[model samples]
Target: MTATLMTGTDLAAEMVAKAADRARALQERTGVQPCLATVLVGDDPASATYVRMKQNRSKKAGIGSRSVVLPAETTTEDLVAELTKLSEDPAVHGILLQHPVPAQIDERAAFEAIDPAKDVDGVTTRSFGAMAFGEPGFRSATPGGIMRLLEAYDVPIAGAHAVVIGRSPILGKPVGMLLLASNATVTYTHSRTTDLPAIVRTADIVVAAVGRANFLQGDWLKPGAVVVDAGYNEGNVGDVDFAAAAEVASLITPVPGGVGPMTIALLLEQAVDAAEAQTA
Candidate 1:
């Protein structure tokens, strides 16, 4: 049987529209506009484009966005200072430090600079702790988006065996935690994992986030497994080979049109939530 398509593009559009209305209502209720501050260092073209896309989406959602661009040589101390300023700004409701900052900078330090209340992207140590413990807090945008998509499609999570590849701080680790919180038995694997295919084949749900071009093949999937490809590599390829996976998976998400749209939409939605919470 051909796999059912789980397209995030249409879902994200619907989410953004609701977020826009929430933003408008928050501003009307408290005279406080939702504002997101995006920080980027070292002018990576892809990172710049991502930041710009977020800013554009924020505007369309009726939320305000501020961008902080730093030179490639920016020091860790300086980057932290910049993020700190945004964190303390009462008007700024959310803080997002674009990942892969300059090599010399301490990315973790910069991420920690944002206050927990404004950590809408959910990249802070505090946010991770909250997720691990199943506490209420902002979730990392990508993982949160994946969960939303799963819920929207009514993919059964409770008691399902979920195999999550990759162990990155925000993406893999937290996503696995989220699935576990939803009662899915989670098995997290990485590059060093031996017999990766064997592990993946046992999963009823799969989240491919290895960050390589078509690294996870389609045939490794268990027939009728629900697949979420969270990887977007060069040439518009995802971690899982979409063509091959679609033929086998009971449900599959496509590259570019899948997880990509959901990330920004969730970010905007969380920003509105932060604004409303902070004002209250």
Candidate 2:
């Protein structure tokens, strides 16, 4: 049986519409538009495009956008200082630091500079801990989006065996934690994982977040396993071999339209939530 596609475009749009309504209401009540501050370092074309896309979506959601572009040679201290300033800004409800800042900057250090209250992208250590403990707090945007997508499609999560093919702090690790919180048994694998395909075959659900294009083959999937491709490599290719995996898996998410849109939608929605909480 051919796999049914789990398209996130429509769901993301619905979520964005709801966020826009909330943003409007918040503005009406407080005279303050929910704002999202984005920090970008260097001139990576791909990162620039992602930042632009987020800013544009924020506008559509009735959220104000503050863009901070730092030089490629910026030191870690400077970046931290900038993040701290944004964190303390009462008008800014959410702060997102585009990933892969630069080789020179201490990425984790900069992430820590963002106040947990304004960490809408959920990169801070506190946010990660909160998510791990299933406590109330902002989730890492992409993982949060992935959970929403799974729920929207009515995919059974609890008690399922989920193999996550990455261990990145933001995407892979957190997604696995979320699945565990949903009662799914989680196995995390990284580049060092031996017999990766064999592990994948045992999963009821497979999340490909290794950042490699077409890294997971179709033969690796169980006949009815659900696939969520969270990788967006060069040329829009995903971690899974989409065409091949679709022939075997029961459900799959495509690149570009799957996790990407949902991520931005959740970021905007969380920004609105932060605004309301801070004001209240």
Candidate 3:
């Protein structure tokens, strides 16, 4: 039997359109459009493209976007000052600082400057804590999107063994917490994990977010497993080898067509949510 490919792009587009309608209604009701402030430092081509894509999608979703482009030589303090300003601006509902800001800039310091209420990207430590403890607050966008995808597909999560590879605070770790919140038994593994394939073989569900190009192998997947590939590596490749994994797993997400689009869609949707929350 051919495994079902769960590409999120089409689904995400549908979600964005639905969200846009809601955002427009909210704007009409309150005369306040939800705005996201996206901060980019230096001229990394990939980062530039990602930010542009986000802004375009946001506008299409009836959400407003503000961009800040800092010089390559910008200091951490300079970045923090801008974030602080955005945080204090009631008109800006969410702030997203694209990763790999610069070696000279302290990324965490910049993330912490975003007010929790406006932390739509869910990179702030405050949001991290809330997610870890299962408290109510904004969640990391990509992780939240993954959950939304699962729900949209009607995947059963409760009592499932969810094995998550990678442990980064923004993406991987937050995803594990969310799986746990859904009552899944979660196991996190990283580079140092011994016999990684053996561990992955036990998972009923798997989430690959290690940012490596086709790192997870197909043979490692349990037959009938539900797979979520969160890696957006160079050339639009994913952590799990989609061609191979699809043959093994019951449901698998493609690299370019899977988690990537959903992430940005969720970001814009959350930005609108944050704006409405602020206005209310």
In order, the Cα lDDT scores of the candidates are: 0.93, 0.95, 0.90
Best by lDDT: 2
Ordered by lDDT, highest first, the candidates read: 2, 1, 3
> For model 1, how does the per-residue alpha-carbon lDDT over 1-280 read when each residue is reduced to its tens digit?
4999899999999999999999999889888899999998987899999999999999999999988899999999999898889988898999999997878888888899999999999999999888888999999999999999999999999999999999999899999999999999999999899999999999999999999989888889999999999999988889988888888899999898988899989999999999999899
Model 3 Cα lDDT, one tens digit per residue, 113-141? 99999999999889988988999788899
Distance from true location, Cα of 129 in model 3, Å? 1.6
Of 1 and 2, the candidate ahead on lDDT is 2
What residue runs in model 2 are displaced by over 4 Å at the alpha carbon?
Answer: none
lDDT of 3: 0.90
| Candidate with the larger lDDT of 1 and 3 | 1
List candidate 3 segments past 4 Å from native.
Answer: none
Worst 10 residues of 3 by lDDT: 1-10
lDDT of 1: 0.93
TM-score of every candidate: 0.98, 0.99, 0.97
Query: Residue 76's C-alpha lDDT in candidate 2?
Result: 99
List the RMSD of every prediction in angstroms. Answer: 0.9, 0.7, 1.1
User: Best candidate, TM-score-wise?
Assistant: 2
lDDT of 2: 0.95
